[model samples]
Target: MTAVWRKSPQDFGDALNIRETVFVKEQGFANEFDETDKTCDHLILYDGEKAVGCARIFPDGEAGWHIGRVAVLPEYRGKGLGARLLCEAEKRVLELGGKMLCLSAQMQAEGFYKKLGYRTVSEPYLDEHCPHVRMEKIL
Candidate 1:
C-alpha cells in the first residue's frame, strides 16, 4: 500500500533525498535545492517504508498556490504516484483557502497533467535546459 503525508520539519530529509535522487542525480538539474523549500509545504509519498515521491506547494503571491519540484523515484513511475501527489497538493491548497493551483510542467509530462484536469496556460519554454509549460487547475 502507499500513503501520502505532509512532512514535518524533521521529515524534510526524506523528502529532500527523494528530490535529489530524481531531480539532480537522475535528471541532471542544476541547483536542485533552493531557499524556497524552507517556506513551502512539502508532501511525501511512501510505499511501505520507502519514500518514493515528493512535491512542494507555495503561495503564488496571489490567490492560488504554485506546485513544483514534483518527483517520483524512477522505479515508482507508471504507478500513479505522481497523480496521487498532485491530488494531495490540490487538497491542501483548498484547505488553505486557495482557489486554484498551478505548476510549470516539463514538456514530457504535459499530457499526464492534462489527464488530471490541468489546462495549459502558456507556450512551451525552456527551464533547467528542458522544455516546460505552465499549467493550472481550479480547485
Candidate 2:
C-alpha cells in the first residue's frame, strides 16, 4: 500500500482522533489530550483515502522538536505504518530546520522508539496514568 503524507488541519484532527481513541480511551490516559495539540505540527499518513497513522511535533523551546501523540488504528498496526508516520514527522521537522527530536514514549513502546534511533534519557515516569520514558534523537 502506498502511504501519502500531508500537513493539513483536517488531517491533523483525524490524527488526533485516532490518538485519542487509542491513548485516551483504550489506554485510560485521562489527560492524553493536551494543549500541545494546539501548537504542534501534525503529520498524517494516509493509505489511499484512509488515514492509517499520524504523529505531531512541536517546538520544545529548547532548540528541539517534541514528538507526541503518535498512533495507528488497531487494524493498521504491524504493517509499519507507525514507522512511516514517524519518519515523515522527522522529515518535516528537519525541513523546518530542527536538529533534535524528543518524545515521552509509553514504556511498552520504548523498544519501538529505540529502533527508530531514539535513546531513553530518563527513567520511566507516570504520564496520564501510564508509565513512560523520555526519549530523544539528534537529527
Candidate 3:
C-alpha cells in the first residue's frame, strides 16, 4: 500500500530525495529546491519503504493555499499515485481552513489537473524554462 502524509523534520530527507530524482534529475528544473521549502507544509508519498512522490503546500495570502513541487518518480507513473498524492495535499489545505487551492501546472500536465477540477486562471507562461499555467480549485 502507498501512504501519503505530512512530512516531519526527519522525513524531509526522504521527501527531498524523491523531489530531486523526479524534478531535478528527470525534469531538469534548476530550482527544484527553493526557499519556500523551509516554510511550506510538505507531503511525502511512499510505496512501502520506498519514497515515490512528494509535494508542498503553503498559505497563499490569507484565503488560499498554494500547492507546488508536486512530483512522482517516473517508474511510478500511470498508477494513479499522482492524483492520490495531490488529493492528500488538498486535504491539508482544507484542514488549514483554506477557501481555495492553487498551483502552477506545467503545460503538458494541465489536463491532469483539469481532471481533478482545477481551472486555469492564467495564460501560459514560462516557469523554470517550461510552459506553465496557473490553476485553482475551490475547497
Report each candidate's C-alpha RMSD, comma-separated, in the order given: 1.4, 1.9, 1.3
Candidate 2, residues 70-89, lDDT tens digits: the string is: 88888889988888877887
Give candidate 3 regions above 4 Å deviation.
7-9
Quantify how close model 3 is to the true structure by its C-alpha RMSD in Å.
Answer: 1.3
Cα lDDT listed for each candidate = 0.88, 0.81, 0.85
User: What are the per-model numbers of colliding residue pairs?
Assistant: 0, 0, 0
lDDT of 1 by residue, 28-131 (tens): 99988888888888888887888889899999957889999999999889988899999889988899999999999999999999999999999999997999
**Deviating ranges (above 4 Å) for candidate 1:** 1-9
C-alpha RMSD between model 1 and the true structure = 1.4
- Residue 121, model 1: Cα distance from true site in angstroms: 0.6
Q: List, residue by residue over 1-139, the lDDT tens digit for candidate 3.
A: 4655654566577888988888888888888877777777888877888888888888888889999888888888999988987888888788878989999999999999999999999999999789999999998
Model 2 TM-score?
Answer: 0.89
Better of 2 and 3 by TM-score: 3
Query: Worst ten-residue run, lDDT, model 1?
Result: 1-10
